[model samples]
Target: MTQELSPCIRTVNVMRYVTPLREGGSMPAIVEADDDFMYVVKFRGAGQGIKALIAELIGGEIARALGLKIPEIVFANLDASLGRTEPDEEIQDLLKASVGLNLAVHYLSRAITYDPTVTTIEPLLASKVVWLDCLLTNVDRTARNTNMLMWNKELWLIDHGACLYFHHNWTNWEEQSKRPFVQVKDHVLLPQASELAAVDALFKPILTEERIRAIVGLVPSEWLTFNVENETAEERREVYIQFLLTRIANSAIFLNEAQHARQSLI
Candidate 1:
């Protein structure tokens, strides 16, 4: 339950566009960077827009704070000229528009996707992951689309852009924060979780206001350009921090919902 500042997200320059990952609606691509590291770059110009990137930053960082394994995230600088070399018009447009700051997740070499039938997770880890998805109200981590990776025999969380859905409708985020996360029932790890209350007790105290603020602070100012309810970008950032603080303060509301989900699954 101790609070500590997370390391600042590193910034890198994209050197080469390797290939596009066409699996998801948002066309994230595998790109090589100046640091000699490969990354899965999430372009700001994608249909999902910059809000998705913000959610990925905040949600992924929060997951990291909760002791879950995730690839290192970085701010990738993309030059517009890199798009002209691509033949595909779609990718060309994406790259051209994403000529500034983009989000990139460090690629895990030879990592396998998590398959429930083949992989058995420990109860504590399962409970923690389920708890995290619930807290973030992430609806994408269901059985059909388990956004998890198995690398080096360890479970790693990924693709958290679908979280923090309240941001999409920022008119009443305060009320939305207090609302129960009803999507917990569909979480892929719900059946495997054996200790929901224990997970709550362990994480609730650790995610203090200071820690949440630090996580939100990691989001770049350019990505916070969306004006919600006439609030400026800086004001919108504070609102995000407040929404998270409210949700954690009312953690029991979502915890009870998750415990019920676990009971039904068991």
Candidate 2:
């Protein structure tokens, strides 16, 4: 696979420790940054580990490539000293451990959580979002936890730290790539997605190996250097690129599965 660089992801310095969003397991925080914007920061020291941040970078970028709406993703620079003022030991420890590069998602002001009853989505847009989630094996977009937000009357995707799950267990990831993502059935937008085949046709060609590699390339070496099953950091990065390439190559089976789900639901 070709290794070409994409536009560099912007990096920002965290200025203040805003309130922690405790609803989710990771306890991500809403903080103000040196850029004068508020961001929902996902720390590398979180229990989910750096691999989760890798997924966020790769998954969020791919969503953007597919013309889906997602908040701006940036590398958040945290200082260990920032934890000194916080009284909460948990947050203090988290801040200290994440004193380097972390993940920051631009916080959308006045954005409401997506409610199926309150808002309706265009069928084509819904299909595209569902297709992309399926391709990434994201199981976090279910009704109980639709990680989607509505801002300025447009739907925006978020919280992709739970995606690209195959990396959680690298063993036999090649075989896992071909497996159908059954979780697509529970996707909040699946019922409204009637054009699965069209979505497949439109996106399949766009997600070429080079494009996927470029997205993977956006991940920081620090995040990818974790020792996984004795594989070197570079080797682990290659594994991510290979897994995605395999998934794209075998997308027909996954697309068929999505179509079957849509047929049953719609």
Superposition error at 21 for model 2 (Å): 0.5
Q: lDDT for model 2, please.
A: 0.87
Q: Write the per-residue lDDT of candidate 1 for residues 1-266, one digit (tens) a residue.
A: 23257658999999999999999788999999999999999999999989989999999999999889989999999997899899999999999989999999999999998999899899999999988888888999888999999999999999999999998988899999998899999988889888888999999888988889889988877678744345567887898899999988888999999888778877
Clashes of each: 0, 0
RMSD of 1: 1.5
Candidate 1, pairs of clashing residues: none
TM-score of each: 0.96, 0.95
In angstroms, the error of model 1 at 25 is 1.2
Across 108-193, the per-residue lDDT of candidate 2 in tens digits comes to 99999999878888889888988888889999998899999999989999999999999888788988888999989999998888
In model 2, what is the error at residue 172, expressed in angstroms? 1.0
Could you say which candidate leads in TM-score?
A: 1
